[model samples]
Target: MAAGVARSDDLRREPVLPPGFSLVTLRESGDAFGHAQAIAAEAGAATLVWVRRFDIVEFAVVLEPDAILAEARLAHYLAMNALADALAIHSPPERPLLFRWPDALTYDLGLIGGGRLAWPADCPENQVPDWLVFGAMVRATTMSPFQPGQTGVGMAEEGFEEVDAVDLIEAFARHLMLGVSRWQEEGAKPAARRWLDRLEKVTGVRHGIEPNGDLVATSQHGVERKGLVEALAKVDWLDRESGGPKL
Candidate 1:
């Protein structure tokens, strides 16, 4: 179910989003993605549902696209691209922010968080759905002592002194605008290349996204494919107990 939402009454200031975007702020425990999915029809396009918390940055954006859900799911890549740019805006020089496609964001190879997608349950892949939601969660601060062999990290602990949950959210919105414009002007190639650039460099390998949003890799051996739909169902980086990225 969608969680309850309010505006600036609970915030010092609302996120600075582009003109077409609106925000619904949720309390710490609220599920931004679920809420955005639930109210997509009425809330409409570019509605960003954000969970206010200091320990982790969590939010979801509502999208109303004309393409069928299968094709429209590529918006997930666009969201990740924007997120990469957002973190870069505040990251220390040379801090490597990496991504594992379909879903997973890492910093210096440690799991920080990633993204998720949700659409109408009854919507058919062949039909244009009412909306799609791309939700992202990033660990903002560590609340517990670090354990040996742990691979998760919070932004602050990694020298991201200038980044906070709210700041990153605002930056993401700004970059998303450029992503949309780039998609309009140059087609998917530009966005796909940007997303591809951040992955671990592999020699003799090439990557691309298919029209249906599959992750495709071509190498001297052969071509391999991964379905976006199936991949989205697996939350490999999520730590269910803490409701944050895996550690």
Candidate 2:
């Protein structure tokens, strides 16, 4: 189910990923997520699509799960958890890293890039899909002029002086491997717990992750279930005009 490299550019150093992980390197202007979705079938599992750039860290990976599409969608949470874990590895002590429910990642109360998932369009909800792509981005530095009092922050602004785009991608790959292994061995609970813990705290509300990746919120009023698929349909953290995370 694995072993392939779609492409590699000469400018950037090849990423040091784990065994079975192939790389597809793109130029700065390329789209990591879309490219991975486009080439997932040929690339097979563990093929990481990386966009070479200085202002942002962009990457995505192909996954082939035994479970059906709905169940496999839980991989989104696992990806997000691994992303946060990777950031934490090089973060300043006690830096606040969080997620905005289904897909957005937040750092120190500011919006950063988040995770996105894709599957073959023809695949049924109950059927196993040929491939799934989990993609993500993080602002390594502000590509545009910074505005005062804005809620968006880049890694440089948050005291990550020693980290770079390659560092993040390499870290995320390692963390991703660990997360997937834990989920496969123990169950979704381990991954779910880590994902839930990183969620921004909601006043007086306790959160639970449903087996199918739904968000179960239990507060004083009652239990409200937010469908994972629906929530990920429109990403609130993304800024369409700028083509990046909202500022």
Highest TM-score among the candidates is held by which one? 2
Per-residue accuracy of model 2 over 43-117 as CA lDDT, tens digit each: 899999988876667899999988999888888988998899888886776768889978889888888779899
For candidate 2, the lDDT comes to 0.83
Off by over 4 Å in 1: 1-11
In order, the Cα lDDT scores of the candidates are 0.82, 0.83
Write out the backbone clash pairs for model 2. Answer: none
Report the alpha-carbon TM-score of model 2 versus the true structure: 0.92
Model 1 lDDT, residue 63, Cα: 83
What's model 1's overall lDDT? 0.82
